[model samples]
Target chain A: MSEAESSTAAQAVAPVQVHYCEVCTFPLEYCEFGSSFKKCKESLQKEDPELYDKYYSDEALQAKLGTLSLEAQAKLEKEAAKKEAKAEAKADAALKKKLASQVTIKRIERNKRKHVTSVHGLEAFGVDLKKAAKQFAQKFATGASVTKNLQGQEEIIVQGDVSGEIVELIEEGVGVLKGIPIDNVVEVEDKPKKKGGD
Target chain B: MFKKFSPSTDISGQTSVKSSVQRSLRTNILSQWKVDPETFDQIWPKKEPITLVKCREHISIYQLHGEPLFFQHYDGPLFPTLRLVHKYPFILPKVGVDRGAIRFLLAGAHMMCPGLTSKGGYLPPADSGLPAGAAVAIFAEGKEHAVGLGVLKLSTEDIKKVNKDIGVETVHYLGDDLWAIQKL
Candidate 1:
């Protein structure tokens, strides 16, 4: 009885290590319900054939249908396939939109000699605006902040006119500025409006 | 509670927990869970401070090194994240649902009583029945890892007797938005 108690205690202390699928981030057994079931299955088959066989073998599939009827299983599979297609299409559309979006860097004239560079639309490429502002501040030793534009859209405004350097850094993919295409980056000059009745 | 969470908009702020609050929280977790001291220590070390992420509602998440370990609703019982439950499967009493309910559970629906009383499902026997409002790790039929975490809305015996309605209120599930945000 003491030996059995010790074994149980040991078991209680140890944590179980679970294997997760890379494609869907679910456990290996739950990949069937994930949207990327086919990709998960293929990846698992390539990584660990034995484990894949245990989950996907003919006998294993038969055993999994113990309580659920064949018709229910068929319906579930159909639903899973539909979900996969929908998710795939959604991801493709998002990617296309991101690629099509343009990043605008405007050099606004604060005075005759001073200007502030405002970068817009970097968030569309998955970059954190606050972090990018901090990076710009540190890289150029100037004050950079995220503020709303006339359209109420957030943009990073740097203290000095560093539009050329900003474009070069973005092209080089510095820090959090990765994945932004150089071709999509456009430079614009916003001259201060002439004072009325000057 | 985390079915439709998005970190960017939903989260309000994050602050490190005070030592006094951390002590009470540690004790609360020790009493509430079946985890051993050594295992708990490994999960949350003595020197490391936990971050409390306050969301839009009364929900607050406890994160360790950017990985969310647990969350709470108001002053309710702390529920472990599904990822944490997957690693330490024995922390909560386990209740499984049948194969047919797996898809619905993944879609963030509450677990019905029939799913628990079905042939493929399992509940603790009468001698060790759980009371209502107890946290449970939800497993799926023929699956080893937990698919969700929930709180029992009905006692184990009452569930078996009635065998209808929502038995478990799912707090977090496998493919919910909470599971998608691996790091904060």
Candidate 2:
């Protein structure tokens, strides 16, 4: 049989054991036990002792004790529902966190973009600045320099300061290096960088 | 001999790698420099761990006064391969010449491999008593041996011949120290 088909058959024929912890009935052995179920029972007991006592009575439990105690059974189902709800809540929280991180990161990146582009009328290429600078230096024969500051971040420092036409040439050079559309330039006050690239 | 020192910023004109970029630049030069393939193999051997950390950015030069002490107590050759990068120089503290990593040194030979950073997790103290800041890879085939990238004043052909005699490939250069692979 194929791998998928074999797996399905194996699963169908396999003896699945549900592990329930003796004290808490927590699902211990990889969800085989009922730790969560006991947790539910405890919560119910804490929330309303009178309801817990009524539901957890020996006689009532004995009636449905074929597979599980009535109280334990109720507890397991309640726990299952709570677990699904908890998982959904967690997923929602994670999504929100991810979006917030992205938004913050994008904002910082956008702010930095202004500086790289502003000085030389060149937009930030953002692709391994050192490599790009090396390539640019080779092509333009302008002896472009790549430096890394104390912080281990890389930057491409191209020569010649310009405003209108000179700025356009530099921008063109940058475009040649980055192979991307040049955005508008904005000034950046960056610390003098050191040199390094792998 | 009076200790020779230079300002770390002088890179364009300097031939000898400065103290700050010594360790990294040495490794890079050794890795990049011209060498025959067969000779490269004999001088420089390949293994899992890339012990040398590349620091081509900024180097800080210093004229150290005293010798660094290794964890082990042996007086052999002291090949100084000392240089620290810009701000991150203080990443690992130096007890003497040898900096401590994940594996805390128990004795000269025995080390507990905690395997913390995937570089085998532990390092025994260097047998060489010198305070050389060398990146050594200690492993066992039949017995234990150590290999690291070091800086030596040997030419390309000399390095190749050394590798041929040593029966390994490629010499890793760590500024001023030739970390020749050798059986301990």
* All candidates: TM-score of chain A: 0.91, 0.26
Which portions of model 2 miss their true places by more than 4 Å?
A: A1-162, A174-181, A186-198, B1-13, B16-135, B139-184
lDDT per model, in order? 0.91, 0.31
Q: What is the interface RMSD of each candidate, in Å?
A: 4.0, 26.7
| C-alpha lDDT of residue B130 in model 1 | 96
Q: Give a tens-digit lDDT track for model 2, residues B29-139.
A: 335332223332332233311122111233222112221111111221222232111111111211111112101111122222221112222222344221223323322
Residue B8 accuracy (lDDT) in model 2: 27
- DockQ per candidate: 0.54, 0.01
Count of backbone clashes, every candidate in sequence: 0, 39
Which residue pairs does candidate 1 place in steric collision?
Answer: none
Best by DockQ: 1
Task: List candidate 1 stretches off by more than 4 Å.
Answer: A1-12, A196-198
